[model samples]
Target chain A: MTTPTSRPDPRPAVTMSVGRDKHSHYSYRDFFRFNREQGTIIDWNNTQNLLLSEDFIVGLQTGLEREVGDASAAVMYTIGIDWGKRDAAHFSQWYEREYGVGVKQSNLLFLLETWWWPFTAQGWGKWEVETESKQKGFLFINLFDSMVARTLGDVGKPVCHLYAGLFAGFFTTMTSKELSCIEIQCYAMGETYCKFLLGGQERIDAANFWISEGASAREIARRLHQE
Target chain B: MNSMFAELLQNAEGRYLHPDELESLRAYVEGIPKRVRIYQVLHSKESVLLDRVMEKFQPTLPHLTRRHGILAWERCRRDLGMVWRYCCMAMLLNDEDYLRDKLLYWLETILKSFKMRDECRPAYKLMLDSLASIFTAEESEIIRPYLLLAKTMLVG
Candidate 1:
């Protein structure tokens, strides 16, 4: 009989290391800092901080309602679209600096997430973006824990118009094509998460009409799918 | 690595320093023990420190979120985490030029894009409070100057 012999394990054991060799994972922390003495917030590159309060955000919404009435949503949406354009420009520069590659050269999902990281850090909720229909000039976004609607409770109607406008604006800038968005579902409507559909003006208009006729989100999705 | 560091620093000044000058500065900061100690403590306590800081901000998060939106508050939380990490690395390098470069580069971009200066105060105070609660007197003494330096640069 052949004698059996034990062999040393060939696989390397996994161990965490704290050493100079490992590159520190870059995070939002790498980008900014705050000073208490001067009551200022500055980025790591030493620029002044621009900040706002929750009161300002809500007040913007309410103040618009008082001034422009029903036209407020359109104004907010228009503002978001413009903001998105500026953000795209800023993001292009920032991304190039941080990663040594232009934003245009990055992978789509990576680019979107990187673009949204600041908003997330700035106190928007976490989100998931669906670009499955990007080639068709449309996309879907689901936002969990939406700040705008989180405290608004179940008012039974979509209450995240600002986010909808933001998506519409940001995407329009990113794609260099006019896109609009509508919140088909919202946390204020007693949903677990808010859902938004963004596409060209024609598609959004159809969705809006269907929505006015009381179409369910699923029905709207199916209808938009056919379009 | 040396070239990259020099390039980043030069980018900050908008002009390149002489190669010899960059090398001298790099060599000077190479392995100071106090710097290493600060890095070790910061890295070791990072998660614990973050949790404490978050707890300190807990009561205010709802108010902040209600006003700014969840997206903004989320960003604020994340930025606080990053601030701690940056402070640690900045302290370890002990290179003022490097710190200034990183500060100017990041701040310029953030400030240009978003109006978020007001959010910094609470976060800074909470971070200092968290650090005080955790660090021993000797440890705090060693790390305090570096922390303050980072805070000043950030504010400046």
Candidate 2:
């Protein structure tokens, strides 16, 4: 929790930029403020957040499995969906207030990136939203360093149901449409990263069936014409 | 720099910045042009810089072929380019946390997944060497911290 200081940087500020964001380059200092005296971590949008440990995540997942058995994935997904929906509502309010633009009026890619930055700061890992084939009824979201997959180890199955549900929930609330998301590929399944397919329930269910039939992520993308 | 000013302003809600704070502000203000200049050079020749680093890195990872998954040079191209973008942004922001929070952690995971941790040391050196070849000693000095951070996070 370093306080803001105007002391001459002992070292030269050797940063290089490409003229993007000219004066408003996003920085964590402005975004995640740690107030030690108050013992609080407040984000740019003034949201209070926690720094959850790997052990806590692992324990929560395993505990759910023990309590609900095979339904743990579903439970996680449900939680993510609920969390996502809430985040959308929360995000819209802050976003409009901060940017002086309604969420609906903002550029799509910019809007999504702005929405996800806080999540990245919160250690949910980073993501790429592939909208090349969004018109075909679905899109691919590539997630790297998924907190769940990294902590749970490789269990030979998709371990990002929570992310799937989170995307599912967030999109549903934002779009005012019923949408579903499925983790088509996962790091826990020995992939380099996690990939989620977001689309209508039918598409997600079809992807689920394809996974049950041993379809790879590439195959799923091909079937969906996402390539 | 922006947040620092914001903090000073917040503190000034009742009282003005004292001598110490003004002196601090002078230091940060003087460094802004240097950062912007570094960014200008790096941004103008980013493609050339990236290609140079790749050219230098090629012989080191000989076993990694384009046909190989993450081990391939092709994969490195994309990730390396991405790293460069963030590095430039981080440097321009003149903030180390900008690099770590925004990109390095995610990149470390991606690298580990590809089992390319061994690539960091040489890559870091090569990038530094490339920067040295391109910029003056003073310029390279400023860029070194961010590169060092990338090396540490990706490999250590």
DockQ of each: 0.02, 0.04
- Scored by lDDT, model 1 comes in at 0.66
What's the TM for model 2?
0.59
Write candidate 1's Cα lDDT for B12-125 as tens digits: 596667788668766645746766876787789887877887777767656767765668656666766666665666666655444444443344234323434455656666
Candidate lDDT (C-alpha), each: 0.66, 0.77
lDDT of 1 by residue, A67-108 (tens): 999888788767766666666766777667767887777667
Cα lDDT, model 1, residue A129: 80
The sequence of per-residue lDDT tens digits that candidate 2 reaches over residues A137-163 is 788999999999999889999989889
Q: Which regions of candidate 2 deviate over 4 angstroms? A: A1-26, B1-156
Per-residue lDDT tens digits for candidate 2, residues B29-86, read 8888998998888778777877888887888777676436565676577666777777
Candidate 1 - chain A - TM: 0.79
- Candidate 1 regions exceeding 4 Å error are A1-31, A43-53, B1-156
Candidate 2 local lDDT, residue A4? 22
